[model samples]
Target: MVKKNDQLIVTIEDIGANGEGIGKYQGYTLFIKNTAVGDKVLVKVMKAGKSYGYARLMEIIEPSAFRVSPICPIAGKCGGCQIMHLDYEKQLEYKEDKVRNCLTKIGGFDKITMEPIVGMDYPYYYRNKSQFPVGKNKEGKVVIGFYASRTHSIIDTDHCYIGADVNIKIIKFMRSFTEKYNIEPYDEVKHTGLLRHILTRMGYKTGEVMVCLVINGKDIPHKNKLVEGLRKIPGMKSICLNINTSNTNVILGEKVIKVWGETYIEDYIGKVKYRISPLSFFQVNPIQTEKLYNLALEYADLQGDEVVWDLYCGIGTISLFLAEKAKKVYGVEIIPQAIEDAKVNARINGIDNAEFYVGAAEEILPKKHKEENISADVIVVDPPRKGCDQKLLDTIISIAPKKVVYVSCDPATLARDLKYLHEGGYELKKVRPVDQFGHSVHVETVVLMCASSEAGKC
Candidate 1:
């Protein structure tokens, strides 16, 4: 029970995952949002408990030297960007520290030295994709913005600090769209509306963009109008409509129909151009994606005529990339649509050395291991947030490749898989943290694994 008279001056000891100030009040830990480390501030207790207290910053008596003015005015209030207040370099440092801490503190595994965090060369224009939630403000005007942190409330941001120039233009363009079409905002309580989300992804190299509009119900009365209207917008490579009727918070919902333009997007990655369908998963930031894949290939240490197994290969991106470098690449995925897209992507790209299968990694990999007369020289696994299942990990251990390049989006899960792999005889060579998605807590990392106990680890 915090009172009016309670005042405390404390230093922010660390930064939390969602980019908050981590410290202690008395013997309990406290997490203060929108705060930086090395900042000495007086906080007013908002809610108090025996273990910890929630407090608001009364005054920053001593501010950190590293603290800088946040670029986005709605940064603290909006839940979009987290590290805008901290300098770009310092943000990378914080990410590195966070990864390392997750490895040691959470996973209880060590020995692999994490390389310096790779930051986006262009921070502000790095985000190729951004989703804006649509809502109606108190005045009943259409409010388009992101969800406030940890709440159902909305934060209407006129300007997103990290989005590309084209993205911002698209958002502004969409405002006219919502206004002209009279598209109703989705009401969470009543669960009725027309528009749900605006998803946009831009290609850095090709200058092409794929815009997807997620709607509420099946009866898209004016979808054709929307397609025709949005088609007039400049720089839009393709536009799609994905109808999501489920009462869930999952983004992209159920991809119902592909209206106007093409059902997919065409973008160039390195020398290859990929056909990205709405359901297909691709990295949001295109420029940083190039760097990330290049770094992963470098870490994989691929040799000519080597067979590489790409597990959880969405749309066979890694397989296509590694095709020319390796003798053959076998990509495995669970999503049938994605696998079909992958095969088509490979065929269109003239990548014959890559073959894709439609099944889960934990299901398909072991059968292939038994039937195939050959083992892989290199194995690359990029799983979703849940990480590798124990069965898949066992398969990986059994068919231990000469080198393993595991790409992870979740550090905690990555650390868990790493601990399992480390126990199974693979040695952690290095971890390279790539900031493909900046301003968010999510970190994309590439960990190289080498056989430590001789050539028989397989």
Candidate 2:
């Protein structure tokens, strides 16, 4: 019987959904982290379950062909990037397979066509946004880095390989500034201290950067000194302070005060300009985002005279993209700030045919469809990781749009939502997985579905 602390050799047969390597020994399933498929490893079982167990990889006896030395020394310790041990090419393949498996196993559809995963040429250092948690390590010193795995403990990294180059400099500057000013890092357990997190946002194309500091209090002592230090860096657009006094896992607070520069920074994605604020849901990878949006536009197949609806529209990024080709586009988001940004973004791009609304997409769509008899030729949905609510899926079916373009971040939820849509009369067509987050387990996918009839009817 497999017991805790048992050291045994195991051969990794496959990669699990969470990027952990799965192996079996004497019919006991073991999940080992920092491992790769086709590798044989000596693992020490950490915990034993009834049918499965978790392990810590002690040594890789035989490395997989896809295995490559990770770029970051603490890559395995940090939760930011998974599958970093796997080669980039194999990573792409794994992501594609993940999407395919989700659709097949969850959606229960195997006849769908899958396009080659759109990957980044230069995958590393592509992240435009980064949020570094500030906490004290075991030595009781101020540490700034990502949370280690499932724990809130800091890994104390000087640099993150996947984050923007400017992030390292910003973190270093903050570390110095905090230490000099005698600012204490927040202790979640005791619910004491001030500085909690350091968030950095960069505009890849425009070369703009925004640094926002999260604090337990409303103000920071020696704020001017910190602002002046941050302004020394070129392209620093905005510096803001977000106050989160609550003792919770949430990073940002309800109140945000600008310390220096503008409250928001500007960035362009394929001719469409967007003003990204601290809370805006902008895509982290701009280069890959353009490709992902372009692929979505392609799948949308706008013919210059279509009425488009973009649900869960974040600052009208996709709505504006589709507006140029469609006759008119209507965008709906639950967040008022996002809706306001959407309207401003539309005006910035000189797009007059796009309209914005603030309400729950599921509720608003059904209400609009009933009261105004609204109809759409193409409906584009980019819901949260939880995917579309069942009511939203039912609403989409009832509205009966000619085409549905789904932009999904989570494959399992995407497949489930696709299943609901497919059962509602839309035929599953083409699926393209875009690697927006390289070196990470996350994969963004765009799917195209068309109604069986020209005038969609349930």
Candidate 3:
């Protein structure tokens, strides 16, 4: 029987949702971290259960053929890139299987048409945005990096292979600047200190950068010097401060004070210009995002005569793209600020047919459909990881749009909601998984579903 601290050898058979290796020991499943599929490794049981247990990899007896030496030195220690050790091609295959498995097993789809996954040409340095937690190590020295796996403990690192190259310089500067100014790193346990995190956003195409310092207090000690130093960095267009005096794990606060330069940075996703602020919910991967949106646009199959509904549209990123081909587009988001940005994005792009609304998609959409009698020919939903609410799903069924394009980050939730819609007279069509966050277990999938009654018309 498996018990805590029991040493055993197991051959990894599969990868879990969080990139953990799943292997069986005498019919009992064990989940081991920092291990990959096709790997034979010695593991120590951490927490043993009846059917399954958690284990820690002690030694890799035989490395998998799909396993590769991670480019980042601290990739294993840092939780930012979970599957960096896996081959890129294998990673894509895993993601594709992940989506397919969810649809077949969870969504209960018998035979669903699936398209090949969209992957980045060059996967490294694709992240345009990075959030580095500022904390002190056990040795009492300041460290800036990501947290360890499932823990708040920060893993010190000088660079990340998946993030922008400028992030290295930013980290170096912050390390020295904090040391020189004696800036205290926030200790979440004690809830003290000034600097909590360093947030950065880079426009891959525009060459514009925005740096926002997340502080535990209202202001910084040496504000002018900090701004001067950060401004010296190339492509530095915006410098801002986010104040979160509360004792919480949340990174950014509601209040944002621009210290210098522009309030927001400009970026392009397939010719659609967007103004990104410190708090905006923009996709971190720009290159893959353009491809993802293009796939969504194709799935939407707009013909310039259909009125489209874009639910949970952040900064009108997808809405504007659809607006270019649709007769009119209505975007709904819970964040008022994102709605405002969406309106601004539409105006800047000279897209007059798109309209923005602020409120929960579930509530606002049902209300608009009932009260305003706003009907859509095609409905595009890019909901959060939780997927669309039941109320909104019912509304979509009642309205019976000709097509429903779902963009999801979580396959499980996507399958759950797709099942609900599939039962609601929507026929599942093409489904494509997009590798938005390479080296991570997370994947973005775009699915197209047409109303069963209107399938012939669509």
Candidate 4:
């Protein structure tokens, strides 16, 4: 009987995927944002349905023990971090439970081994990459920051709690530079102005930084002055421009123009040096990336003589890691630029056993297996959010690698794909969730599966 604008007091019992609190009142489920489990809160129903409804948190009558004061003053208003209000320990626990629940409820795994989640000792300031949108506020001054939750409206802030500390300096420089030149901030509504977004990437180990300004036009006014100002900053290695003349939500365009310095910045992930360009799909967190990849390598369990196939290998991050232990590794990716980067990374690292191919994994893997009779003893797949394609799954089953290591970003799609693999005669062995994104609801999980015949043996 609950309708819109109904006021009620509810006890939060669970947290949803997006970090919303779930509470039940008289058999009706209410989802409220900015509230955590074990909290008793007053809420007003925003959109009421028959069995479930969305509500807005009015007041917290009692706070959860796991809840903590977020380091960022604008944590609740900014869309960057979802679960920052929750303690880091509880955040790890929730992510572990999320993976377990997905496997049990969605994958139908009645019994499965799940290891404890690997978390960072210090989660804040871990992000090596940050993108800020540029726009004008109500007062007609240039504003730069992340968008508010679920809205395109930018929330002006000098610093992001989770991003690299250098981001603040960069933002400040841009604010002043824009003001001095009277540069126009891109207006998404009217499709006018010039600068749209600013992207910055840092090499956590190398202390190298790259800045790419996304603009609505091909060039920026007073580009030399902008470059000079940016070069004054420490570790400034690359300054570039990304032209996206089209009116679209997508951040980057196909063309990238180097304004100053190098076109790419070099970084290391476990001794493997990688040259990261502005368009590269590198993991944002370097500390946790090492842990995550090391876990994947352990799951791969290469004996120094195994032939491994790395599917959807971006810039050869995981592929090169596996190649260090495996006798030979073949990496397949759909993006040509990524494959080129992978090749360059392998050569730069002096790794001769790794090879890169440019094509869709589903199409290329099967063709290679058929034409070259290339069979792998172990297979590693780091698929996108949508998970592996059915054809790729079928090919893996047919190849029958002794060990199949799957690195997933989405738990739901992962569960669905795991079900497909399990039905195809693979046994789920070990599942470990890694907290790559600390406060965000997103988590990365690495799973180990073995052929049915070699289940317990592995």
Off by over 4 Å in 1: 1-5, 219-228, 455-458
Q: Is candidate 2 or candidate 4 better by lDDT?
A: 4
Tens-digit per-residue lDDT, 1-458, candidate 3: 89999999999999998899999999999998888899999999999888999999999999999999998888887888899999999999999999999999999998989999998899999999999999999899999999987899999887888999999888898899999999999999999999999999999999999899999988888878888888888999999899999989899999999899987999999989999999999999999999999999998888789989999898999999888899989999988999999999998999999999998777777788789888889999999899988988998898889999999999999999999999999999899999999999999999999999877766
Q: Please give the distance, in angstroms, between residue 231's alpha carbon in candidate 1 and its true position after superposition.
A: 3.0
Candidates ranked by TM-score: 4, 3, 2, 1
What clash pairs does model 1 have?
none
Model 3 Cα displacement at 299 (Å)?
A: 0.7
**TM-score for candidate 4:** 0.99
Highest lDDT: give the candidate number.
Answer: 4
| Cα shift from native, residue 370, model 1 (Å) | 1.2
Total clashing pairs for each candidate: 0, 0, 0, 0
Tell me each candidate's TM-score. 0.93, 0.98, 0.98, 0.99
For residues 259-347, write the lDDT of model 1, one tens digit per residue: 67677767777877888877778777877777788887898766778989899999887788888789889999888888998989898
Candidate 1 local Cα displacement, residue 118, angstroms: 1.3
Q: Each candidate's lDDT (Cα)?
A: 0.79, 0.92, 0.92, 0.94
The Cα error of candidate 2 at residue 363, in Å, is: 2.1
Residue pairs that clash (backbone atoms under 3 angstroms), model 4: none
What is candidate 4's lDDT per residue for 351-380, written digit by digit as tens? 999999999877887788889998889999
